[model samples]
Target: MFPTSRIPLMGGLSKMSSSLMANVVHTPSILNSRSTYILERARPLPRIYPRQRKRPYMNRSTYVYKVVQQPYDRLMRQQDLQVILVQYVEGLGKAGDIVTVNPNYAYNNLLLPKLAIYASPENLANASLYKKSAEEEAYSSKTSKTLMRLLPYHTIPVVLNQDNEWTIEPWHIKASARKVGIHVLNEASIQIPGPPIRGPDQSLHGKDFIAIFKVNNKETIKMRCKIFIWATKPAERNSIENQFWCFKGEPVHPEEKDDLDLLPIEQFNPDKIIIPSGDLENTIVCAS
Candidate 1:
């Protein structure tokens, strides 16, 4: 009775244990109810974040070039060449028939020194008679002035290969088209604008006029040409197709006609034609 005021600590511990047991028994239903409420209110993840899909990469397109070939069956007509020489002739005799001048005549005489042959006496007599009957006109005088102007030789004709890789030098003038492998139509001297002494030092070379032909079973060919010539003048770059003739022998002036035929250097096509650039000193190509 005298110590009754102090309640035992054992009683408090027992009470706390009882309360915890009650909470454990009732807590299951409470937790189930909370879970139901959460299920109703919860939201799903964003659509973008669900699954990552890779985008396909794109590629650039390419283009191709096409080359067209012509039909081999296409035919070209060829005609025989008839040489017409118009020169200051003393007369036409058996001995005066077309004579070829020696190439050395130019050096010997100034321009051309070579002499193929001299006019015979009989030819001289005929020439004298013809001269007497016809009106005395100067040899330099233009005969058939209108027709002479129309002559093909007055303008040179040149054909260019595909790709325009090859071009004639002395590129100032343009060439007219003439029958292949034939006499120059108009045979007039090219007119130089300035004095004779002040002409261009660099004319197209005889060797630059390249000719291609087929040979024998050995697949041989010939080219009568020299190496390519570069332009000394800047303006000449566009003038590559100028008409110029290359002969085997010395070139004849419009006033002189002493050649029966012109010799040409010929070569096989594709196999023999070549163009090299930039100090090509050691490249010596021989063609037959």
Candidate 2:
């Protein structure tokens, strides 16, 4: 015969014990050899990695280098420029003359204006022919000598008709000679003793001056001419005495003292005096 209370107590103890064993079986053991083997066999927990730094992005198309090439012939043409004149260019040469000039100058001033052509053999030949012809027709020494002889004896008169004060220039002397059947082509051929004649010191009126001419650029061939300024219309005066003031190496007159005082010291030469005759005495002469 089982006791009724002892039966219930035994049932409850069995239930509790079963629950405790289940819990013990589920828990991991630190000291157990089986647990240690399983842990060694399993893959290590996925390594926790610090976040990686992002790299900066760049577009390769944004950076680019380009090189430009110039043609070789274009550079060469600018350095070496040769041209020939089809027509006469003063200070350069006569027609058909070959010359070297800047490319821009040749194109704009010569080629564009049809004044010159490119240097060629045919143009050179023509230039040579022209030079030969010009030399043959050039003024001869005999003619130049004859002109030179006449220059010393003759006087060229320049008349300044303008009422206002005017300065005497080399051109004026040339023009005066031209009027008197003498042609002076080159300005350098005429030589003045002093600077260009200007007022109120050196006037263009009522004065007798001398100019030297270099005949045909020859050192030995020189001519001296008397240049007289006729402030008023020239009168009929054959002798130099009538045309100009005559001072025969005499003392300055009381009336002329005022004029002499007014004259520049450089112009007043005490030793020199204007003679009444055709011969110029004690005159200062300069030659170039």
Candidate 3:
């Protein structure tokens, strides 16, 4: 007595129920346990870390220090430097920059600080001394140069007479001057010409001459003179012996005698002599 619609409801219901159970219960125990373990391990640990203690920076003072108060004395005692202590009204009191005494300490704490001003006694003393010395040296150098330029000539001439009475003639006086550095330039002696001669028959005849002196090949100054000797016999122009030599008598080599290159011979004439204003004390005569 089986029913006409009997298509095995039990089998179909059992398959449907099994499919529903498979779809509804999807949680995996192994996967869930692994995720739970990872989460537990990832949680922050409460570990103890020791705190590091930082060393405090030592504060330094800004002040200059030296072995002795007097910089010059201290410097003298030292082997190297020679210091001069000088006083200055300006910059009396200032602070010295803080400097490091040790390099092993942290550089931030050990290096010099920018809080210092110029306060070193040595530095101030050096500045003052240098200033004074510089001024004095400048003034002295200027004066020396001026004096050197002013004194162009140094020697004068004095004539010798028969009785040795010195008679300084204008020509001799003018020719006496010598340049300051080396020998006199363009030096010439004016010759004293012998007076006119009376002929054997007692006729009036004269020969007046001018002495010509030359430096190297160039002619220097000339001396005009007339001398009266036996019957007014004229003498050849040779009066340099009578003229005083400006230089002290020294035996000089012939080659060295002409080595002094001086001004030309034509410059000593009276026409070109122009005395500067208030410079008569330093008058220079020329060569002719």
TM-score of each: 0.17, 0.30, 0.18
| Tens-place lDDT digits, model 1, residues 1-288 | 223224332212444444444433333233312221111213333345336675433223212223232222122112222111223333321211343343343234322322222344554445433332123433322233322333322222232332234433322222322223223233232232211211122343322232222211112122222223445444443232211222232232322222213322232344433442322221221110
Clashing pairs in 2: none
Report the lDDT of model 2 for residue 258.
42
Write candidate 3's Cα lDDT for 81-187 as tens digits: 21221222112211221222223321232223322223256554444433444333322322333333333223222222232223334354334333212243433
Q: What residue runs in model 2 are displaced by over 4 Å at the alpha carbon?
A: 1-140, 200-206, 220-288
At residue 107, give the lDDT of candidate 2: 89
lDDT of 2 by residue, 1-288 (tens): 223332222222344454444433332231122221111212233344478355434345334433232223343223656887666665556555677888898889889999888767676666554432445533334255455444554445555443346666778788777765677889888875545555433233344455667766663332223334332323522234432322221111234334333322223334655444432221222110
TM for candidate 3 is 0.18
Q: How many backbone clashes does candidate 1 have?
A: 19
Candidates sorted by TM-score, descending order? Answer: 2, 3, 1
Root-mean-square deviation of candidate 3: 36.8
Model 1 stretches astray by more than 4 angstroms:
1-198, 201-230, 233-252, 255-260, 278-288
Worst lDDT run of 10 residues, candidate 3, spans 88-97
Please report, in order, the local distance difference test score of every candidate based on alpha carbons.
Answer: 0.29, 0.48, 0.29
Superposed by TM-score, candidate 2 places the C-alpha of residue 112 at a distance from the truth, in angstroms, of: 62
lDDT of 2 at 25: 31
Per-residue error for 8 in candidate 2, Å, reads 99
